[model samples]
Target: MTPPLAVDIDGTLTDSNRALDPRVLDPIREWPEPVVVATGKALPYPVGLCEFLGIPVRVIAENGGAVYLADDDELEFHGDREAAQRVVEEYRELGHEVGYGKVDFTNRWRETELAVNLDQPLEPLKELAAAHGMHVFDTGYAYHVTSPGVDKGEGLRAVCDRLGVGIEEFAVVGDSENDAAAFELAGTAVAVANADETAKAAADHVTEGSYGDGFLEALDSLRDA
Candidate 1:
């Protein structure tokens, strides 16, 4: 039997322009096993994606700050939101723009962490998060400030427990550092051709294709396995 799939959204399922590639929809919807949409994006994005894709609403959002399973209608939050918010506030006080400007929706719906635009200086942000006992993850698209124990691996473990599946019974795919934890827990970890170095290093296999094509390639490999 093919292992269940846990896949990232941005660099993994999107095109170079960061738009969702329609190509991945049918295959994911048709997959026999459960498919989890794991991403550094906010909870609503992945949840809505699952609804639109006609798949189970299983997701690890905010880089693992949040986990939701539709089967049981469960939603769990793991990160320290207050601490993350404080870091962002301090960053703003330092005269550094969060990058998303005022009235930023990128963080409006975020409940457990802060997602800052990539244009901001990473080092200072990292330092601030660290000072608050939080961690900053660069997902290649944004800088995510989350609690130390909150990560995709732990989120996946939570989902697995609810589903009665082992942590090693999933095949995970991603293209950034935020996905590394899930890679470590997966039985097979796949990275796209455009994957960041950190992601490639953790992956068991690197696809020759990029973006959604790479995701399709990974799915094919799983089917063949």
Candidate 2:
């Protein structure tokens, strides 16, 4: 039997320009095993994507801060939002906005972590998060400030426990630093050609194709395995 799939969005499922590649829709929708959309994006995006794709709404969002399982209609939050918020507030005091404008919808509905625009300076932000007992992970799209002990691997473990599956029984695909943890836990970890060094180092396989094409390649390999 095919293992359940946990996939990232952004650089993994999108084109170079970060637009969702329409080609990935059918395969993911038709996947026989459980498909979990794990992303550094906020909860709503993945949940809405699953709804649109006609799949169960299983997601690990905010890097690992929030998890939702459709079977029990359960939404669990594991990160310390107040700690993250404090870090963001300090960042703001340092004369840097979260990079999104006043009406920043990017973080409007986010419950556990803070997403900072890539344009903002990263080093200081990382320092600020660390000072607050949080960590910053760059997903190639944004800088996510999350509480300690929360990451994609831990999120996948949580999902697996709830699904009655082992963490080693999943196939994970991703392209950035935020994905490295999940890659370490998955039985088969695939990194797309566009993956960063961290992700590639943790993956068992690296696809030649980039973006959505890489994702498709990984999917085909899983189906054949």
Candidate 3:
């Protein structure tokens, strides 16, 4: 059997305009194995995608700060919500916009991270996290302030266990720094053509196409592997 597949959403499976390319949906419907939508977006977005594809899949949301199993409608969180809320307050006081009102509807449901779209340098955010006993990560779209222990890698590991598969049986695809740890854990680490330098450096393979096209290519290769 082909191993379970894990993929990032934004900048990997979605187009530059943040729209899901319809081309990728049918292939997902026919996939013989479990597909995990590993993303930083909230649960509802990915759940809606799975529904549109007419397939059952797992979700690792909040940048691995939380995991949601579609079958069970269960949620497993890894970060401290109180600390995350405090980080949001700190960022707002520092004159940076933070929270759902500033970003989107998903921000209101976020439990473990505060995502900000300040478009500022990340170093200062990292410094702020240090003071709050937290960690900061960039997902190519926004700055995420989260608990130091929460990440996509941890989420992937949890998903692997739930699926009763090992990391070596998995092929992971992503396009940013938050995906680095997951890349390290997968048997085949693939980066899309437009992936960040760090993510490309960590991958075993880099697809020629970008976004959904790249993900389709990677999934085809994994199915044949």
lDDT of each: 0.92, 0.93, 0.82
Identify the runs in model 2 with alpha carbons over 4 angstroms from their true place: none
Pick by lDDT: 1 or 3, better one:
1
In angstroms, give how far residue 78 of model 1 lies from its true place. Answer: 0.3
Residue 71, candidate 3: how far off, in angstroms?
4.7
Which candidate's lDDT is highest? 2
Q: Rank all candidate structures by their TM-score, best first, as comma-separated numbers.
A: 1, 2, 3
Residue 37 lDDT, candidate 1, scale 0-100: 94
> In candidate 1, how many Å is residue 202 off?
0.6
lDDT tens digits, residue span 1-225, model 3: 577788888889889887877888787778787888888887677777877778885888888988877667678989887886786677667876653464377577777787776465577677778898998887778888889878888998988877678988888899998888899898889999988998999999999999999989988888788
C-alpha displacement of 95 in model 3, angstroms?
1.9
Per-residue CA lDDT of candidate 2, range 1-225, in tens?
Answer: 677999999999999998999999999998999999999998999999999999999999999889999978889998888888999999989998898898998999999998999999999899998898888888889999988789999999999999999888999999999999999999999999999999999999999999999999999999999
lDDT of 3 at 134: 93
After TM-score superposition, the amount by which residue 210's alpha carbon in candidate 2 deviates from its true location, in angstroms, is 0.1
- Clash totals in order: 0, 0, 0
lDDT of prediction 1: 0.92
